[model samples]
Target: MTGMTAEVMTPKEVETAKEAAIAPKFVTKGVDVYYAEKQALTNVSLDIETNQVTSLIGPSGCGKSTYLRCLNRMNDTIDICRVMGDILLDGADIYSREMDVVHLRARVGMVFQKPNPFPKSIYENVCYGPKIHGIAKNKAELDDIVHTSLQKAGLWNEVKDRMHEPGTGLSGGQQQRLCIARAVAVQPDVILMDEPCSALDPIATAKIEELIDELRVNYTIVIVTHSMQQAARVSQRTGFFHLGELVEVGETEQIFTNPKDERTQGYITGRFG
Candidate 1:
């Protein structure tokens, strides 16, 4: 496994692998990202299945977050960042000249590592994206979306009485859940979470993990988490990245119990992280 290369598969091997994999929602081929002269990702090709939770696990600065940002063109926000690859969302190229970055973001929403909610009220924070995207036509529709998003995020019951309160006033855990509610309000095709539980306590983290499992039924989810146990608990598929490259990817159980790459094995078994 030490000599294993990056997805260098024969036609037969590719077909064999496909036999076990679900059809992809996002197809990334030779995806690469560069910040100034430094390369962040190198020829990463992976398929994210629809209606499933796929987790990306790696050490710090190993390009896990960089690669996750590529899903919805989030990297475009950085002036020095340059992306080269074909990232197709449902067979349509996301980086095509005709692609609308705003629409793309609406279709694929993101939740950051920290709970960076707006300085507005909890209800306003949840309603902000839907209003901007014109997802809600009237007050009733807006209210429905807000209610459903918070309900789905497991925060409605806790924060319902305080709808007019500022989002920053909530506890760290509640703030994070509010952020999740905000992302869900847009009704995106895919949800990208970057260490969403990193700032949370065990109870808060467990609740978020439960919400993730429930959300996968309606939306495809891709998460970047540092904790191996969290990945095992929440994700169906797991991808291990090392040194700006994807070392291996497979079913979560297989990746944990029988890794094909030495790097993946080392990272998982506390040999190195």
Candidate 2:
């Protein structure tokens, strides 16, 4: 044993190392939100993996949307809102003073509860983000970005011939897709959707669900949905929130079928929200 050594790792240890190498896209710990004197979220901690759909399912006002907005600092728009805790994107603090809110929002785009496309033409609706973010330099570049974004959003063929038409002129589903296209045009690493299909018909909702599944291949998606069925259909991971706290989180299948927490089981069984 003249200063010689041999090292070996078991299969379990090797797997643990591999998992540790791939960090989560977003890591939130002890996040609390306040609007004036009222507390909205309390000590919530969660890790959102990259390129996966993570659904937040709970009753209305459970702070699901509040947590989603925290990812991009959307709550800052509210005069009385204040957020505290650590939120990390790519292991960097998103809530730090050095973080640029505008750029952070560009990296983490949002789709609202309703389809709120700009009043501009469909092309403009998709082009605006790229233009403002300087993602496109010239006419041809802008055109390409708009086209590609629409394609990613699964609305290209439906609206290609109507690029110049007002975005608001499209049907509810198409308009929602247009809003998604707008968010994609910014080339975000993450997308936040808040009850995106609540206003659409069942058919349209199905289409949006399909698009969400497809988009997860390239972008990390966090969706706040009231429909447990939608969450089961679209997400790989699911988190149950109740009364401003995260009750449980796990694989979508496991969460719905065999939740560890009784609260999760009760909610899944329709006992209570």
Assess each prediction's global lDDT (C-alpha) against the native: 0.91, 0.91
> What are the runs in model 2 whose C-alpha is more than 4 Å off?
1-21
Give the Å error, residue 16, model 2: 18
Alpha-carbon runs more than 4 Å astray in model 1: 1-22
- With a 3 Å backbone cut-off (N, CA, C), the pairs that clash in candidate 2 are none
Please report the TM-score between candidate 1 and the true structure. 0.91
Q: What number of backbone clashes does candidate 1 have, counting pairs of residues 3 or more apart or in separate chains?
A: 0
What overall lDDT, based on C-alpha atoms, would model 2 receive against the true structure?
Answer: 0.91
Q: List TM-score per model, in order.
A: 0.91, 0.91
Error of 1 at 49 (Å): 0.6
Q: Lowest lDDT 10-mer window, candidate 1?
A: 1-10
lDDT of model 1, residue 183: 88
RMSD of each: 8.7, 7.9
CA RMSD (A), model 1: 8.7
